[model samples]
Target: MALPVGIFALFVLMVLPIPPLLLDIFFVLNIAISVAVLMVALNARQPLDFSSFPSVLLFATLLRLALNVASTRIVLVNGHEGGNAAGEIIESFGQFLVGGNFAVGLFVFCILLIINMIVITKGAGRVSEVSARFVLDALPGKQMAIDADIAAGLITADEARTRRREVTIEADFYGSMDGASKFVKGDAIAALLILGVNIIAGFALGMISHGLSAGEAGELYITLAVGDALVAQVPALLLSIAAAAIVTRVADARDLSGQIGGQFADPRGWLPVALILAAIGMVPAMPQLIFFPAAAIAGALWWTLRQRAARPAPVEQPVEEVSPDRIDIADVSDQTLVTVELGYGLVHLVDKDKGAPLLTRITGIRKQLSRDLGFVLPQFRIRDSLDVGANEYRVLLGGLAIAHGTAKPSRLLAIDTGEVRPGHGLTGEATRDPSFDCPALWIDPAARDHAVSEGFLTVDPSTVIATHANQELLRNSDQLLGPEEVRALVDDLKERAPALIEAIHPDPLGLAALTRIFRALIADGIALAHPQPLLTSLALALQKTQDFDSVIDAVRADMGARLIARICEPGERLKVVTLDAALEGAILGGMVDPGTGQPLIEPDCGSMIAERVNRHIDEAKGPVALIVQPPARRALAALLRQRASRCLVLSINELPARQPVEVVGVIGADNPAHQLPAPTEEVQAA
Candidate 1:
């Protein structure tokens, strides 16, 4: 209601004749509004903080233009009466501001017009145009960065949505600014034209209507004309400056004044300024009095700033006394199961002042892992260590370093996952991705869009570290489970199915046996996220035998379909890489490990088998299973666990009867025999 009423009033001011007293009030109000807007623009930390500035500027321009129309009417109609015939504000500008000289007032008004139209308004308009273009061009890349963060588990869905909204608001604000700048430019031109009309009309009206002499008409009418122009131009200049300030801001955490002051606070900058001023002061033709005093002020500022810079930071005294003989366990050991230690240079990724992006990403990873593994993982501890390289970080499981990688804290990693176009011409520090060993480059953060356009997946330093940690956690998930985790799993299951829990715990299988079986299942790529069916299978398997091996075998055989589902989708034949019949026979009757009495393949044979399986796995580019007899399953699984980790090892009994399988290749066969024909539809036992 207020906005509509104010807009109606602006139209009324332009259409109806305004009294001199009311005109004066409107002039002062316009000037006040312009000043208040300038102050707000200067204090804004970012352009989006003043999102309403464009609309405000439009209304303010209309008000000023309306005031100009009303003031022009009064000046032309009341010129012959006196200088005060129009308004006190205009009279002061004509006499006091320019000293009663119409020529000087005209000169001042023209200079103000030039500054507003050519210097400030022009530059601000150009900046607004460029800013809008760049913002719109980078919109896609910015959205991609948010999506990448979400995919890397650095932020949740809600945070991503908020970031996307902010990006949209920023684009809209700059776009509006680009259009609103024209208002300021047009206002300046309109003021110049109004000045011309006021002077010509007032000059002719005074002579023609009141029969005044040429000199008297010029003196009275021209002075008021220049005064009206100057009055309007003053506020116009202020508004132009305000617009310039708003568009030129660089989105800092501090306001305009604080940002400038902080950048100019360096003592070294002041010292050079003092030297330059002092050198100029010594010249014979220069004004030594002014230059010397300016030099002294600079020198004094430098001295004061240097003293402040040199002051040592205050240190706090310890409040507690400690005995030398006492030893704390926390200082010597880490209680957390997973620990991430970063070098000094990478510590900023975890700094709370910078939003602690690494901490947030790690928390997201933990949540994701807990959901996948079906248990609450222990809290991961992050700390700084001086032993590692400045850019290196290590992931420690149970205080032992399992995986380590280097990251550039100030740059982004653009990974080429075999999709980058040839001759992309990217220049940076060449490196390999630590997580996947893919070709990558450590490029400047500014080149993220270029890299993305070139088909490279660019990720920030925090995302890189979090991804490495996520991969390592999944690989070593079996070790992460313990008695406490197993206990918690059983307790949670008890609440949902107390009868099933009673059948398994403390009777045939105790906590220790249950923990070991769950660990084995997890190691074999069977997740316990759905505990009801898995625990039920284990309870039923226990009724047949108490032998640990037999119990695991029965449970795995019952859950064979679930294990196969992890790798192969339904309605698709599973690709199987198997050993030759002779090779399997030799392995079944091979030398045994004395400790566990399990069949062990010779070293050379094991390496050859691992190499051949890896080749087939790579060629397939999907999950492949190695089918062997029950006795050889353990040995082959252990051999391929490191070399061909993607290959799922399954025994004859563990393979589902109804599941369709394709024998992709056979290891330990000649090159011609390697390309074997597809077998029958059903899976055949090895």
Candidate 2:
């Protein structure tokens, strides 16, 4: 309401004749407002801190122009009387301030106009135009950076919102400054025109009406005109300087004075100036008194600066050591089911304040894996490590590093999805995709479009780290499903089917044995997406046998069809590599220590079987299983676990009867030369 009323009153000032006392008060108010604006501009740490400066500058310019009209009215109307026509503020400028010389006042007014119009206003306008253009051009890149930080989990939603608001305000301030500069330029021109009118019109009217001569009228009226212009121009000059200061302000945490003093604090900077001044002082033609004293002052400043520079820095206090009794055992523990350790540089990837998306992404990964695996994944702990290199992160499982890699937040990784040839396209730091080790290039963000067009998949550093963590979580799924998770699963299942759990547990299969079976199934790359079939098979298997291995085998056979379908391409015939008749007979005959539950096979025969199966697996494009008789499945699986962990051993009874089977390779028969001598012959001789 105050601003609106003030603006309206400024408009009224142009129409109604202002009293001399009110005019002086208004003149002082204008000076005070301009000074306040200049002070605010100087103290503003960032341009956005004073976002309303352009509007204030506009209002100040209007008010000054309005005062010009009122002062002009009083000057032309009453200058025929004397120099004290307008008010004391005007009279002081006309007499005491300018030594009662209208010529000196006129010269001063012209100089102020030139400085404001040619120097401050013009320079500020150009800076505003350039700043607005550059800020607008960089807006998209800045927005992307913010979004990338958010995705990386560097900043929280609230912080991102605040930062985005600041960016908008900054752009708006510059754009407004660009337009508001015109007001100052126009005001300078108006001041010139008003000065002309007050002098010429006052002289003409005074000579014709008051019977005064041209010289008397000119002397009297011109003084009033110069006084009015100077008073208005003084505030105008301050406001112009304020505008220039704001437009040129760089974004920083320190105010203009602090920034300037900080930058100029170096002793080395003053030493050169001192030397130049001393050299000039020694010249014969120069004023020895003035130059020598100025040189001496500069030299003294340089010497003082050197003394400050030579002073030793204060030593930091050492950190106090904590007593052993005060240490918490949990704080020193390294036992976490899953942990993500980031280096100092990559810490922004988990900082909610900066908008890093890694934490959120890890949560999503855990949720998806937990849902797919039929058990809730344990909460993964994240911490920053100074021991690791910047941009490097380690994915730890049970306090051990499972996967680690380096990523650059400011750059994008363009992975070649077999679309672009390796070492082709844009030049960059050649690297591998951390998750899959696929060939990739770390390129600048500006080259993302080019990389995409050239058939490369571009991703930021946060995505790369998240992907690596996700892969590690999947690969270590078996270890993640511990006793606690199993107990949790039982508790959840009890809510829906309490009778089913009561039927088999404690009496036949204890919780520990059941957990082992689940772990084994997961280790074999089987998703527990549907738990009913596996649970039903476990219950039925417990009725027949108490052996956990036998129960696991039974569950696998029961879930074979679904698991097989999941592994193979839709509608494609199952392709598997099988052992020869002799190898199967020998393996069955060599099985020993049945009471001990250890199906031991001859090492030579086991190695030969593994070598052949691994070769076939390596050649296959998709997943292929090893088909054997039902009795040999568990023993052979255990024997080949270390050598060929990827080889899936499926019993003939487990799969559909009369199932279409394409024998791609006969494991032992295809390489007859690789077969070992019979264990029976060596044993009989011994």
**Candidate 2, run of 10 with poorest lDDT:** 672-681
Q: TM-score for model 1?
A: 0.54
Please list the C-alpha lDDT of all candidates, in the order they appear. 0.89, 0.82
lDDT (tens digit, per residue) of candidate 1 on 379-460: 7778889989999999999988889999999999999999999999998999999888899999998898999999999999
For model 2, state the Cα shift of residue 484 in Å.
22
Which 10 consecutive positions of candidate 1 have the poorest summed lDDT? 671-680
Tens-place lDDT digits, model 2, residues 117-172: 99999999999999999988877666666655554445765787888887888778
Q: After superposition, how far is residue 60 of candidate 2 from its true place, in Å?
A: 1.2
- Summed backbone clashes in each candidate are 0, 18
